[model samples]
Target: MLINLSKLLSGDQETITEQVTLEMEAFVSSIGTFPVVEKRSFPLKVSKIGADKFLIEGETAVTLDIPCDRCLTPVKVEIPLNISREYDKNTVEEEAEDENLIVGYNLDAEQLIYCEILVNWPMKTLCTEACKGICKKCGANLNHSSCTCDTVELDPRMAKIRDIFNNAK
Candidate 1:
């Protein structure tokens, strides 16, 4: 959704509130793509702070299906986003921040939301804290069922003694 900032920038309106619907089904980034399960229509406030400067603000929550780090199970993770950013029209292209969010004189609502989601993305996602994860040997889901892999730990210092006993046997 693109919002025209002409009125706000033209001094006709000092501030304006525009409601934009988030129409993204998935978020594609450099890391990977995550499916967006839920989002809501929200209003964004655009204010002309000074000459050629504008401030945009809003709040919303987005839920996404992110795979767990340990078990790789898809988990619905809700990420809350607070959008508050200022744009300067006279900024240089190389130095400008969020330059892609501005298309001509219109503000890109979807792009703004994307930036927010990207910044607030969790470093690690888990289905549960006690998730047993997958088996290292047979690649079985430990949380669902146990495997018949080795279940013993021997101290390295006693390895020689244990090996001697094994040869005697």
Candidate 2:
């Protein structure tokens, strides 16, 4: 998925467009294997903006199955991505001050797509908005059903006495 910009860097004002499709499956340390990401084939429009600059824009829809953080349930999520990158013939240091500057003379499109998806990933994933999670007393999943254990409220005044007896052991 690498794009060669030899013609664009040679002062050519002509635009080059391409259609890309990618399927990626990678392992994630904390979350196990990353779910298969299926991206619909779409066109990537590349146009020369300046003699030494080019604008790359495209959009793609992706389907992913990720595990919920709370209950480890498989959640199906769809992500719509619109990406735009600017390629410059000049070195990146020349435009280091610009925050939106993306210097690419020779770049891999798959790497760029992976990075964009990573950036758009949610900070926390849950199966439902109000997931009750697991119970601390009996290690039961509260989302499935309520536990039968009695809910107790300890008296704060007697906490010191309980601590003294606990220390005696």
Candidate 3:
């Protein structure tokens, strides 16, 4: 969804509010792609703040299927988007950030929402706080069952001593 800002830039209109529909089925980035399972339409507002400057604001929510960091299990993560950005024609500060939501006099609503979601993505996701994670040695989910792999962890400083004992066999 693209919103024309020519009227607002010309000062013929002080503000423009439109109910924009999100047309993204998934969010793609360098990390990975997450499916957008749900979304809702919301009103986006663009208002003139200064000469050749404007403010874009909107609120919407979307649910994504993000995997758990420790267990690799898919979890439903609802990301609430309270999008706000400043469009400037004088400097390239936004371009440096790769915001690229605004090009010339057109605002990319989909890109704006995508950027907001990327900024607010969770750093860590877990199925539960007490999740036991997976058995690294056997590749089994510890939360569901136990594994027979050695649980002892030896310090690196004692590796040479353990190697000497093994040579005796």
Candidate 4:
């Protein structure tokens, strides 16, 4: 979706409101591509603040299918996107402080949504707080089932203390 700033720039309307639907199925990030489980509707509002300045604001909710960091299970995570940007047509590329702000007459709605998603995405996603990760020996999901591997629960620093106690005995 491309939003034309001509109306606001030309002083035809003080503000413009539009309900836009983003049909993007996936978003690519450094982690990987996260699939969108639900499409979102954004209520976008653009208001002219000055002769060459505009204020853009919107809110949206989206659900994405991402793998749990521990178990790698597909988890549906809901992300809330709150967008607020000031567009300055007279701003130079070097003078702009925010990279997400629009500088030209045309604004890419999808790209802005993508930027918000990336910004709000969690560093680590877990299906549950008590999720037991996969077993190190057998590669079995500990949350689903138990593993037969004779896993020892030990602290390496206490090994020398154990030896001293054995010698006293």
Every model's TM-score: 0.83, 0.66, 0.84, 0.76
| Minimal lDDT window, size 10, model 1 | 89-98
**Ranking, TM-score, top scorer first:** 3, 1, 4, 2
Tens digits of lDDT, candidate 2, 1-169: 6666656667563777778666466424344666655667788777788766778788986667777777667777776778887756564455233323333555456665665666667677788999876777787778888886546655787878898889998
Whichever of 1 and 3 has more TM-score, that candidate is 3
Clashes of each: 0, 0, 0, 0
Can you write out model 4's per-residue Cα lDDT over 1-169, one digit (the tens) per residue? 8788777777888998888788688977777999999876868999999877778799988899999999999899998888887766677365333453564666667877887787888888899999998887889999999887756655777878898898999
TM-score of candidate 1 versus the correct structure, residues matched by position = 0.83
TM-score preference between candidates 1 and 4, better one = 1
Residue 103 alpha-carbon offset, candidate 3, angstroms: 1.7
Q: Which residue pairs clash within candidate 1?
A: none
How many clashes show up in model 3? 0
Task: Show model 1 residue runs off by greater than 4 Å.
Answer: 92-97, 152-169
Off by over 4 Å in 2: 27-33, 50-52, 89-106, 136-139, 148-169
> What's the CA error at residue 20 for candidate 4, in Å?
0.8
Per-model lDDT: 0.86, 0.67, 0.85, 0.80
Best by lDDT: 1
Cand. 4 Cα-lDDT: 0.80
lDDT score of residue 85 within candidate 1:
82
